[model samples]
Target: MRKSMPEQNTVPTSHEVGSFFRQSETSLFAIILICGGLLAGLAFLDSGQHGLSLVGLGVALGITFMGFQYGFASGWRRFLQIGDGSAVSLHFILAALCALVFIPVTASGLGPSGSLAPVSVSLFVGAFIFGVGMQLANGCGSGVLFSFGGGSGRMIVALPFFVMGSVIGSVILPTFLTFGSLDPIEIGASLDLSGKLGLNLLLLLGAAGLFFWLGRRQGFGLTKRMLGATILIAVLCWAVFMVSRHPWGVTFGFTLWGAKIANLIGLPIEQTTFWNWPGPQRALTHSVLSDTSSLMDFAMIVGAGLWASLSGAFGKADWPDGAQLFAAAIGGLLMGIGARLGFGCNIGAFLAGTASGSMHGWIWFVMAMAGSVLGIRLRARFGF
Candidate 1:
């Protein structure tokens, strides 16, 4: 009787098999898109037709979108839930890691925000305004691009205004610079320590640990999947640096795009001090696809869109009410001005700046957070 025990079912259920295939297909498709996109961008760069590089940039963004989807779908959503600071903490950690690895190994220079400006009155004011704008728009610089790619209707509305605001900010940037800014400060350069890099690594680790503890206390405990996603994102950031020969940037492209449009419409944008710079001048005179930042920005939006559509994450386009629209416009304006005055937005200033070990990045983070609190309060009035 004991030998007559029922046989166990060893085979996987049909549903399990189907799920496996779906996941495999998704992963394979993402890989193909990423590889193809990177190749296309490189080819364009080699051909010296930088303006057409958007095709490649879009593909790269698609990869990033897939990464985000993976993170969100894989128990990482908790860190992104409202009121959780884990996302910001993760950003800082990734930046520090980037600095540690890329700077020493690849000899990567500091991020765009590495050249710090003095702690002037405009710095505080601009950061505060940028923070408020980010909350109201429900997106920062990268956030907006990714959100738009991910089928967020609101972001579509916010994107153009963001561009316009950036242009305006660029136009007025000279005024802000003249407002008594101290010379830019670089932490690693200024320090006299024998092992400056080692000290930076230690400090960054301490900050990451502090943020992790704080996030856990706030009920946003880190998960294994989130850690994996962070590692992947770090790799992507490194790749970007290797390819672009500069750390990742977003808003500078926005400013350039805006300036180009202005110039097309008979605005003497070239006369401005900001645009008179060699880099800005070159970008202005060339095709948009030639600008790495703009190309990447465009690609990110397309990639996000593809991901959102495939993943069923795309939201329907719902028009906002008058108050919400007003808020969006104002928010875009503030973010534009704030980013220019503060030397960069969250991505450029906080993430990239911190990764580069710039003191200004830390300053931007503190002021922006303060602004976010107020922005949140204001956002509620607009029924967000």
Candidate 2:
């Protein structure tokens, strides 16, 4: 009787179980943030004296991740809603604001001028293909990084292929460039408006008008939080310009990574026309930490992961079906190639380009959107 009385219940109570889960989740979130901070710190140290700028970028991106998690409405979901023009239009507005702030401040001394790709048959072709690919893969360059950080399994599949595609694109880019293209067009350069009313004003006004129209059409208005986030991001972009002496960019890092891998595997990356250029060559030869764009990209992914974990947005990813997996791989390849041929992915070519007043940005946007429509249709066929 005394032995039987000594037997105690071993099952955890519901409250105990709940508390355990909460503690585990909190621990996981803390780990992610700590890791992100470490990565950012390493990137800053590796930035060689430009550590301040890297720090600025890391903090800004971290804030942006938090905003995406807490402020924005349906962050990733909005980007995929082709029928709703809000997300695209709002981003354009953000770019416009960045341009309005940085142009006068920088006095047009933005270095690394080669980031601006000229309009050409290859650009249209590549952008169109990229557009399709983004839709099929369900992520753009920035999108893929953030989605992966947010624990999306599909994006993980797309990432490697995207890198491979970028390498292939770099290999073939010289051929595409030989097809002939126009010189890069800078709006401020061609117009006398910068002297009188300021060209940035016109650009900002036009973007604002478009945003308003799109919002009305969609029966939505920018929330206070969203507006605040946009303003913050715009300022961050301006800071990036001030420090880096160039607008924000993303895909170049991918190309660099791809080329490096190719080089390591006995590929003649140095012989490629694109890599032969001074800037590209320097990036290819140097440590990745010294590459500003690459550092920012790395920070962005870590920041996204940290924020997603804190917000409970990071979760186990759903398994993809065979067809879906195939679509992701193919889409990633197309996106990689398209990004190189078109001069950038969505962030580089479209957002940064437009903000910097390059006509190619507008061209990339139109072509990519058109491609997106087709991509969406293709995605449906794959039951995505």
Which of the numbered candidates is closest to the native, going by highest TM-score? 2
Give a tens-digit lDDT track for model 1, residues 1-384: 467769986644445534453555455447646754664666476455443444555455555645464321112123333545566566667777777655464333344223345666667777777888888887788777777665454666778888888888878777877877776666667554436567667767777777777777877755677666777777766766655666677888889888988888998989988888888888898877677777777777667655654664443324466677677777777788788878778777777777766677778877887787777778879987
Q: How close is candidate 2 to the true structure, as a TM-score?
A: 0.84
- In model 1, pairs of residues that clash are 50-289, 50-290, 51-289, 51-290, 58-299, 116-184, 118-182, 149-304, 149-305
Model 1, runs deviating above 4 Å: 1-58, 65-83, 105-119, 190-194, 315-320
Q: Give per-residue CA lDDT, model 2, range 1-384, as digits (tens).
A: 455566775744445533454556667678767876676567656765585466557546754844464311133234447334455556766877877755555554445332366888789988999988888887788777777666666777888899899888888887987888899887667555375226655765576667567666767566677667777777777777777777777777777888888889998888878888899999998977678777777777767766666666544334466677788889889999999899888777887777766789889877987788788778888887
> What are the per-model C-alpha RMSD values against the true structure?
12.0, 7.0
Q: Mark the 10 consecutive residues where model 2 has the least summed lDDT.
A: 69-78
Q: Model 2, 173: alpha-carbon shift in Å?
A: 1.2
**Count of residue pairs whose backbone atoms collide, per candidate:** 9, 0
lDDT of each: 0.68, 0.72
What lDDT does candidate 2 reach at residue 92? Answer: 63
